[model samples]
Target: MLGKTASDNRVFVYEVAGVRQNTDNDKNSYPFRSSSSVFIKVPYQRMNDEMRRITRMGGTILSIKPWTSNNGSGEQSNDGD
Candidate 1:
């Protein structure tokens, strides 16, 4: 029962709504919806960087939660791969 806790190294999933591919700066371009919920497995250390990147891209994070496995067993682990 001795292992790294969920908070030790967590991955968050950013549920971003209204994500457009093209920006308004584009000349006479029609922006398209990229995805409804972009599941980005961001590492604990890169959370800020990812948030910045998402904001820069005009994405509004609707919700953020720790990444989990499909079966809801526990936090998903990235074994350097």
Candidate 2:
């Protein structure tokens, strides 16, 4: 098996919605408030796991994009947009 290298440390951002405040999310200090959506940082190694977890929590995965540093914010880099 090809071992992961430093170059494979890419991170992606997942924009999810419909994750309501529930018993599962009550442990979070900043619990989900009534909102349209939220952005979650997911590492390359944890994409599938995060997806499954989000699905189990009744959250819909809206968009998944490679995360890039925009100044100090982690966002999708789009030159044209």
Q: Give a tens-digit lDDT track for model 2, residues 2-27.
A: 99897477878888889776676677
Q: How do the predictions measure up, each by TM-score? A: 0.57, 0.74
Query: Per-residue alpha-carbon lDDT of model 1 for 1-81, expressed as tens digits?
Result: 878776667767667765555553243233343556555566776778767766866778887786766625432222232
Cα miss at 25, model 2 (Å)?
0.8
RMSD of 2: 7.1
Off by over 4 Å in 2: 1-7, 71-81
TM-score, predicted candidate 2 vs. hidden true structure: 0.74
> In terms of TM-score, how similar is model 1 to the real structure?
0.57
Location of the lowest summed lDDT over 10 successive residues in candidate 1: 71-80
| Ten-residue stretch with the least lDDT total in model 2 | 72-81
lDDT at 70, model 1: 64
